[model samples]
Target: MRLLTVSALLLLLLGPGLALQIQCYQCEEMTHDCATPEFIVNCTVNVQDMCQKEVLVKDDGIHYRKSCASSGACLIASSGYQQFCTGKLNSVCITCCNTPLCNGPRQKKRPPASGAAAPNAPRVGLLPLPLLPLLLLSSTLC
Candidate 1:
């Protein structure tokens, strides 16, 4: 039947389209582990100004990325981080950062002590090295 043929064609063309979705390289937010990351459902990642911070808690972690379309039911890639989205938005860009996000007071990088500084930085106080505890105990005795 002509109707049947058209229906088959439509199904063939549109059925798989529904399975595609956008995937993030490091969606660490959805899944607790990067090995098995989770996705932000029914949402987009705003990569424009969120990549820097691993978890974009401000907007539920979902960005407005457009180029990332998957062949599944709208899924997001995770990398063990956390995120949140306040409303529905698409086409996002995230400003990724190798270090943790700037959450609080920043630790100033100390300038190398002129000549007084030792070649190798010593394991100063309360380190987790093998003999740190023993050294601490010895110092406490003094």
Candidate 2:
């Protein structure tokens, strides 16, 4: 219950969604050396389950399985019960930083002007005392 309360408070205060994950995709097909006739490859940064794991993937003749890596260590792959490596397959991870990827320029958002405030900024003593109490109660209950 405490954890849920804290998570709820964080979601409300932080606005929404997880922060941007600055992933520099370095995978097999992500490299110049790797080109497979059998499969396609893609990668994404997932920040769920209290984990920051990198998902390395390989597609066999039939399907793809992510050989999940947690931070730096390799964990047992999801495609258990199958020995699915091939001579054509290339393993990709952070170590393969030389792997070529098309990255665009980073965008920076400038803050609003310092002297000006939002149009919706609360005016001093705008609401009467009774209304103020009601607003507080509503926010807490909400």
Please give, for residues 1-142, the per-residue lDDT of candidate 1 as tens digits. Answer: 6555655665566554433233333433442323222332222433222222232323444322222222231233332222323233432223332222221123598887786657686856654343444455455555
What candidate 2 gets wrong by more than 4 Å, as runs, is 1-8, 15-17, 26-31, 34-82, 86-142
Report RMSD (Å) for each prediction in the order shown: 23.7, 14.8
Candidate 2 residue pairs in clash (backbone atoms < 3 Å): none
- Shift in Å, residue 76, candidate 1: 18
TM-score of each: 0.19, 0.21
- After TM-score superposition, the amount by which residue 32's alpha carbon in candidate 1 deviates from its true location, in angstroms, is 26
Candidate 1: what lDDT? 0.35
Q: Where is model 1 more than 4 Å wrong at Cα?
A: 1-79, 82-103, 124-142
Q: Find the candidate with the highest TM-score and give its number.
A: 2
| CA lDDT of each prediction against the hidden true structure | 0.35, 0.35
Residue 99, candidate 1: Cα error in Å is 16
Tens-digit lDDT track of model 2 for 1-142: 6555755565565543443333332223331322233322233344211111122345542222222233333223323313433323443322212112212112376788978779699867575443454456556766
* Each model's backbone clash number: 43, 0
